[model samples]
Target chain A: MKEIWTITRRELQAYFDSLMAYILLILFLGFSGFFTWIYGSDIFFVKQANLQVFFSIAYWTLFFFIPALTMRLLSEENRSGTIELLLTKPISEWQVIVAKFLAALLLIVAALALTTPYYITVSSLGNIDNGAVFSGYLALILVSGMYIAIGLFTSSITNNQIVAYLLALSIGIFFQIIFQMLSSNLTGIAGGVTDYLSINSHFESMTRGVIDSRDLIYFLSVIVLGLVFSESMLMKKRSV
Target chain B: MDIVIENMTKTYGRQKAVDNISLQVKTGEILGFLGPNGAGKTTTMKAITSFLIPDSGKIFIGNISVNDNPQEAKKNIGYLPENNPLYEDMPVIDYLQFCARIEGIAKDKINDKVREVIQTCGISREKHKKISELSKGYKQRVGLAQALIHDPEVLILDEPTTGLDPNQIIEIRELIKKIGKEKTVILSSHILAEVEATCDRIVIIKKGKIVADGTVEELRSQAQGNETLKVTIEDGGLDEIFKALQLLNTVELVDFVDKSTQTFQVKSKPGQSSRRDVFNLCVEKGWTLTQLTFIETRLEDIFYELTLDN
Candidate 1:
């Protein structure tokens, strides 16, 4: 546990020390803000108190920004050969994976927190359901956690940052988009399984102002599975 | 207090990186691991450090089996890999402190241990600088400092002095010698002189197997079963001198260069010094004796002979 904390702190500090974090924040906030104020007003004709616009904009923004945030997490370590140093430490492989996961999760959480002004703005406009807004934030966290997990897993597979980014982006898009398309093609239990695997379906269900245990389980499973795969990859490499 | 490897092997696809190799290092001894490129030096070090698992056989650090309990075996080892990977953004001292924490040093003693190692590694002045900002030598020193922060019983360094200037190399060499006095050290290098200077006993590996393992003098004696005798004769015919020395039973090969200002190289039987025989030969040939020197076979010659294609 102590080793995890040590690695987490260093990773967090590294994010802030570089310009990547600031640039990601600006890009994310700028796009989210632009879509919410201008595009939201134009699309709905009369956007009084709806956060639907903000959620839509934020999700699309995260689709690209999260990959940029996580491309270097494990890839840079591999490139610099620091992975050997890290493995030689008196820490388990799971600790390293979990620490890096949490660090990336924290960066996304911080970026999401900066969007709080949109919440306050919507609340002041009209009779916006605070419950829906709160649930939407929860959904965002869960979805972002899943994305970060996938990004970390992709980062583990290669040493090139560009390759890591593209892999993460493709996997992210598949889970968020392609799985949703496949869910509709089947019926009954198989369709249910496909829907459960689709990240957008669960997140969309949660954002509709209801907290379902099934959605929580699906997202958590994805996070756990991604991390386990990363740990196993590291173990396999060390054995060879 | 000792590390024992029995028939350890690691094969990658069709190539054997570390073929069945066994060796031992006693406590508080510096064992130099010398091998040419692709001779399994790094593989052996990685296996010993528990960074890589061997395909067969066993490695025991004290009583813990490395293959069975890698984490336990790693606890007793402090490894400095060839690249010295470090977090470049963190300050030197901060990185060392992190290493100390991960090594499970007591919280109260972490700072003191970091300070001590920084001083011992001669990087006290660069402690506050970011690791990326430090020079290569200082960065290497920081790497060494982090490795020593936990004070493990055994130290494994893979090419620690590589890519350093001559002065820096000497300083790091001396530091390793000092540290080896208190811990078992397994240092790998391709340079025989560096090994001879720092290691108490040397193990030379070729083609993933132990070819020669002994002290400098022992390996030299084993490689060249002959002694080299250098004879310098003053202003005499080299052909006549060679003929006279070639007649001696102790001399196996004699090559005299230059007819005037005669200098001759003579090879004699093992454990034999033919200085007296050469002196008598020179006197008989009426050659004025100016200088006579005997050269012992060096570790370089032994290393080349063992690794070179016969």
Candidate 2:
């Protein structure tokens, strides 16, 4: 556990040590704010009491941002041959994977925290659905974790960060929309299966001011599967 | 603790990167691993450090089996890999501290340990700079420092002196010798002279197999090559002596050394005393021999003979 945290700390420090963290934060906030407040069909246009515009815009922004953030977590280490130095230490592959995952999660949390003024401004304007707002943020956290996991897994697959990012985005597209697309077009058992598996279905349920154990399990399962896949890739590298 | 390996082998696809090979390094001995490119030197080192899992056999570090207990085995080893990859964005001190942390040193002792390692590696002046900003030699020193931060019993340094200038190489060599005084050191290099200068015992591997293992003198004595003799006769009537010298089958090649002194280099078959035969011939020919010297067969000849065999 100590080793894991130490790795996490270093990984997090690396993000801030370079211009990547600042650039990512600025881009995320800029795009999300522009779409939610300054662009067409924003909160003012909808005249809604909650932050559905912000959540919707932020979710899409995070979809692209998380991969860029997580791309370097393992890929850079592999490219620089630091992974050899890291694995030779007294730490397991799983510990390294978990540490990388936690570091990306922490960065997402920081980005979310920076958007607090949006919540404050919306609440001050009119009556808002506090329950729905909390659930929305929580759902964002879960979705961020899912994308980060996929990014990490892709990063472990190759030493190229761009390839990792693209791979993560490609794999994530299936969960983000393909499943939803199939769910709407298919019927009966196939439709039900796709709807149950689609990340949007679970994300949608949480954004409506309700938390379900089933939705939590679905998100947690994807997280576990992605992390486990990343760990397996590392093990293969160690063997190779 | 000493390291032990038995029949360790690692294969990539159909090619065997590390063939079934076994060797041991006794405690407090500096073992130089000499090999050409793609000779499985790095693969074997990686196996010992637990960076790569061998396909078969086992590595034991101080009686701890690396295959069964890799983390524990890794704790006892400080490996400086071939390229010495480091976090370029990280400053020297932070990198050392990170190494110390992963090495399992106490949190409070990390500072002291990093300081001690910096002193040992002679990187104190550049400790404040980022790794990428430092010179190549300084970066190499940082690599050594990280390996020594935990003071592990075993140190596996691959190409430790590579990319360093002559002065820096000597400095690093002396440092390795000092470190090897108390720790078992296994260093790999293509430079035979450096290995001869620093290592107590030298092992040459080729194509994933141990071809030679012994001291410098032992390996040199085993080398089957021609002996070179620098012979200098009086400047007068040197052609007659040169002619008679080349008559003997033992003298393979003869070349002029100096026109003023009539110095001519002569080569003789292995285990044959060219001086005795040449002296008798000089006396018979009435040629006054001013100088007769023997050049020892070098490690280069031995390394080539052992590794370049078809």
Q: Which digits, one per residue and each the tens of the lDDT, describe model 2 over residues B156-274?
A: 99999989999999999999999999999999999989999999999999989999999898887777456789998873576776787899767777888886788999988776767
Best by lDDT: 2
Candidate 2 lDDT by residue in tens digits, A86-182: 9999899999999999998998899899999999999999998899999999999999999999999999999999999999999999988899999
TM per candidate, chain B: 0.96, 0.90
CAPRI-wise, candidate 2 is: medium
- Please give each candidate's TM-score: 0.95, 0.93
Q: Tell me the whole-model lDDT of each prediction, alpha carbons only.
A: 0.86, 0.91
lDDT of 2 at A81: 98
Error of 2 at B217 (Å): 0.8
TM-score of 2: 0.93
For model 1, the superposed segments whose C-alpha errors exceed 4 Å read A41-50, A125-130, A185-191, B283-286
Model 1 error, position B41 (Å): 0.2
Error of 2 at A101 (Å): 1.0
